[model samples]
Target: METGVHPARQPGCHPAHNPRGKPKRPTGRTDGPSRKIEVRALAEELGATLIRAVRRDADDELASVGTGHGPVTISWYAFALEYLDMRWPQIAAKTRNETNAALCAITQVMLRDVRGRPNDELLRRALRDWAFVLPRPEPHAAPPDVRLALRWVARTSRPLTDLMDPAVMRAVMQALRLKQDGTVAAPETQRHKRMTFVNAVRYAIEQGMLDSDPIANINWRIAKTAKRVDPRVVANPAQVRSLLCAVSYVGSYRRARGRRLVGLFAGMYYAGLRPEEAVAVTLPDCVLPAEGWGRVILHVTRTQAGKKWTDTGQLHDERGLKGRPPGETRPVPLPPGLVAIWRESIQTFGTASDGRLFFNERGGILAFSTYDTVWHEARQLGLPSDLVNTPLAARPYDLRHSALSTWLNAGVDPAEVAERAGNSVEVLMTKYAKCLYGRAAIANHRIQALLDEYD
Candidate 1:
């Protein structure tokens, strides 16, 4: 007559075979002491229990799998575990042991019961947050932040269930929703976050834990507030000349470094090479005649990190290139003087052990800090302090801008200029349109002369 005592607890009922709507176990009679399976082995044999739609334990039904480390049910939304079960070998083979370990750790964190309901909404959110902030996998594979986050959860949360509270989710959302310290996050960052969360939410829905994806509802337009950068900081011919003269007259203490700096600046300013591309230049990249001018070809670029993200945005090592595909090559041409400079670097830096033309004292790519410091010192000695601070001729990259503007001003065809500098004619004309005055005057004068002849 509808007794409240759990049927399994009724007298004379076999705990293993209780039939009053209790969870079904594997169909086997209990063997004697030596025949009972170990807990872990039973779990393996009972993996089919995962497909059950009803609560198998009271703790789960009551949401009592709290922070004290009691056994908890596995979550339905454990994408990391499912992903690992299916893709562990693939992930391991593609990256390193540390990465594989991180994946495993995260899987454990996500798969642990939350809400005692065998759901992994929180884990999905964590994965989404991580994938959002990480840089695109280039120069190297993904950093260890996912692994770090998993470890953080393990250490910080009491039982994994504690992490599943609605309040916890609210806190997480609040922390992540922060704007970039008054400045907007870069568009790339914003886009990545949205995509990461979107994918994670999609995974959750696919795993049957969610009816729909929450990430799908959030507006992503807030990221658009970040300003677009103008790429036309290149110098004019007069400014280039002044910059060159400034670079040429380094103090005796900095003479050797200055020469190297001049070569780099000239390569970028005169040849329109990105700073990294300039460092990758080699003797073979340069083509010079005994009597006349020739071209320089830039095959690669070297990148550095750390110092660059500092408030100063300076750098200190050679990490990788931009534009070029991994192991595939890209090239740019140079004028006679730049050709000569590459030749001199070849004789001096002696090429990387790998035949790279520029390197640190240890034969690595030159440090951005070393070059930046040298550039500042060069400025102090060569240009007025007022000029040094002004953007008119500040920063190494401005040389590339100057180079492009000079080409536009010197009557070079827009198509030719764009092709040489790896830009579209439309883009060049739009951003640097105001900086093309000198070349426009030349074109105007030549056109006037032609008109005079017609008259």
Candidate 2:
């Protein structure tokens, strides 16, 4: 028997429409998979009229055998908008962008059918740039092509109920694992996207749409992200000094392009400060003196989260320290050399309008590109040709890594290192475990000294 929607009125009709008063209930088990044609699917086949038929006939067996109807629908696209609106105020700008990126990728799979779908590129832009963001543009006000793409997504987005199907979740997994171009995303990227999806579905469960987290049921394993810092990027103190010296030679003397960042990068090397943390340092945060050592009371990170994503309307987001709550502070000891650099930076370049120690000549937050370009040039000038092409201090962040590793190799207590570096001990040990081996020669020397005394 060919089992599909029928062209003519089927056997399982109620008394209202059929000349036959009411058809007898079908004999087979109603719970079986073959028994139901979901009213939405039936509506697709028979047009809107089938919905009225499903609603009018409340007979469970007959309706189950013909059109399975339950309730009115909320498309996933609209629900996702609502989900985002609820979450907007609470999260930081970076987190908001990250969540949106995850959801934007998942949107490709959440769509119902591709019938009459607009261009893939157009659809993606409409969703990512507008629909996923908190304040969506009015449908009419959107660009003509964007309006069409948004409308298509609105029309064809699958209902929240459809997630009960395991196959739907498998598609979501594929979306998380792959980029829009169908290439594999990085392992950390995959993990981050999955985390966002898990949170979204948890919201669905809270709304009573899902019985449990579908992610809990799925067995998909993403690739493991490396926690350890790459040893190739680590540079010794002497190399770092040479790189800092080289930064001075970049750009004209008046421009002072590379000169502005020497103190900032040195903070990363000597204090194990993240670039963002270094950027946020102010006069109040520093305890520089004509002394042996100083301390920087770190409290915040000023990193770019883009104007589109942030509530502040500024391109840079002034956010609390990573892994620490707002208003909490970390105090890092600064060597006398770094203290002199700080003093000089304050006296020569002066502070930004906000009192931050480092800023562009225009008195704006330093653009990442300026520092990155300067650092690349500095590497070329300062390092030998063999090392310039290598991974050694390739990123300015690697200076912080060098600081942490140097501290670890110097036999500093791991707990103290973790506290100074603003990391948990477990994480610090895991990340710098390979770098810790450099201290073995010193340990051997001490052991040899003891053995010689015994001899």
Best by TM-score, which number? 2
Global local distance difference test of model 1: 0.53
What global local distance difference test value does model 2 have? 0.83
Per-model TM-score, in order, reads 0.55, 0.82
In candidate 2, which residue ranges exceed 4 Å CA deviation? 1-70, 442-455
TM-score of 1: 0.55
Q: Rate the local accuracy (lDDT) of all candidates.
A: 0.53, 0.83
User: How many residue pairs in model 1 have overlapping backbones?
Assistant: 13
Worst 10 residues of 1 by lDDT: 131-140
Tens-digit lDDT string for candidate 1 (1-455): 87789876767565455567575556775556646556667887677676342323321332222322225433422333343333323321212222332332333334333433222444444443342112212312424544434333433333223334555434333333343243444555444444433444465456544555454344335445423224344545666666666665664544465655667777788788777677766666556565446675554555554431222334533323444344544445567666676666666646677666666566666776776776677666666666666666467776777788777777889999987887777877876877867766887999999999979
In TM-score terms, candidate 2 sits at 0.82
* Residue-level lDDT for 272 in candidate 2: 94
